[model samples]
Target: MSLRQTYRLWAPMYDVFLKPATRSARAKNLAQLGRLDGLNLAVIGIGSGLDLDWLRLHARPAQCIGLDITRAMLNKAQIRRRDCPFPLHLIEGDAMQTPLASGQFDYVVLHLILAVVPNPAAVLAEASRLLRPGGQILIFDKFLHPQQKAPLRRFISPLLGLLATRTDVEFEPLLAAHSELTCVRDEPLLARGWFRGITLQKHPINQHPINHHKD
Candidate 1:
């Protein structure tokens, strides 16, 4: 089955199975983004809207949008609207080709998306276009580190992709190639350091240099 079809079947089980299973990691990931109380935010690949509450804590519901490629996922996300304090827009769209205007959002939340999408670099590029200068994009997913070589995992990645997910994607190269965005935070979250919470920001050229200090 294609990624869309797999997610269609996975949508119902997502809130029940995946949500509880990854709750701690999810919370930890969102915490890395800090407080986003008054920003225009967009959640790329917002499956089932499980992270809506976190977005609500950082942004007004009206200022946030949940974009998903599959109709089934968006339909399930509708159930979260009742629980949201403000109105949350559920949009059916591709993360790689979002219809949102360029440089529109203050923040873009990319949770559990990079490993699932076919082209993560494209998604990041589109996100770069959607974010205003200094706007940050929060990423929470499993990615191979720069120095870590996952030979065994890479060999079995084809089997894993049968479930519409990729496990051996390395974030180092992608981020390194994107000159406009800079990594602000990269921390482990779950699975003995397999999954991580990483944040990247689109900053203006020749602006303040990124300080790699513990400040």
Candidate 2:
């Protein structure tokens, strides 16, 4: 099924569906963003804004923009809205093709989104493009680690992979493979049996100096 169709089915139960199964899996990813005060933060495929509380408590970002392809998801987020609107922007767009300009953000965060996209590399490239020099990006999603424990990951992971954006895709090496971005942190919040969470820094794409995004 297409991501939109899958999301159409999931938009209602997404938080509940993810929470029970991926609770331990998603916590640290949420926790990692708390320190990003005053930064321009853009979150792609931000489902229900369930993680907003954690992000706000931690990062205190100067602005927050949430983007998702499904309007239902964005509408749901509006109902769950936290008290402060502090520079909040909502855009209906695809991660692989955003309406925003290049190098237009200080940080980008994706929570369990890549695996389900039709093109994970395209989304990653977008992540690379939207980020300003020295900008940081955080990704929390499934990875089919060849080096992992077999018996455990064997059962649950394939299902996650099946449900993930790019079925059976591996994002672990892709994050490390790129020279433009540096791996600042890698943590396994789940059973560490299968999936992994990653935080990476966007090194300057070129010799250009930092030209941060305009509001």
lDDT of 2: 0.71
lDDT of model 1 at position 68: 92
Clashing pairs for model 1 are 36-58
Query: Candidate 1: misplaced stretches above 4 Å?
Result: 57-62, 205-215
Query: For residues 59-120, could you state the per-residue lDDT of candidate 1 as single tens digits?
Result: 34237888999999999888877777766788999898999999877778899898888898
Model 1 alpha-carbon miss at residue 4, Å? 0.4
Task: Count clashing residue pairs in model 1.
Answer: 1
Tens-digit lDDT string for candidate 2 (1-215) = 55666677788888787767776556667666544556678989887776665554445667888998888788777765555446667788999999988987777988878776767888888888898887778888776765555565556645654454543556666665567888878777665533567887877535543343322
Q: Quote the positional error of residue 150 for candidate 1 in Å.
A: 2.1
Q: How far off is residue 194 in model 1, in Å?
A: 0.9
lDDT of each: 0.80, 0.71
Candidate 1 positional error at 139, Å? 0.4
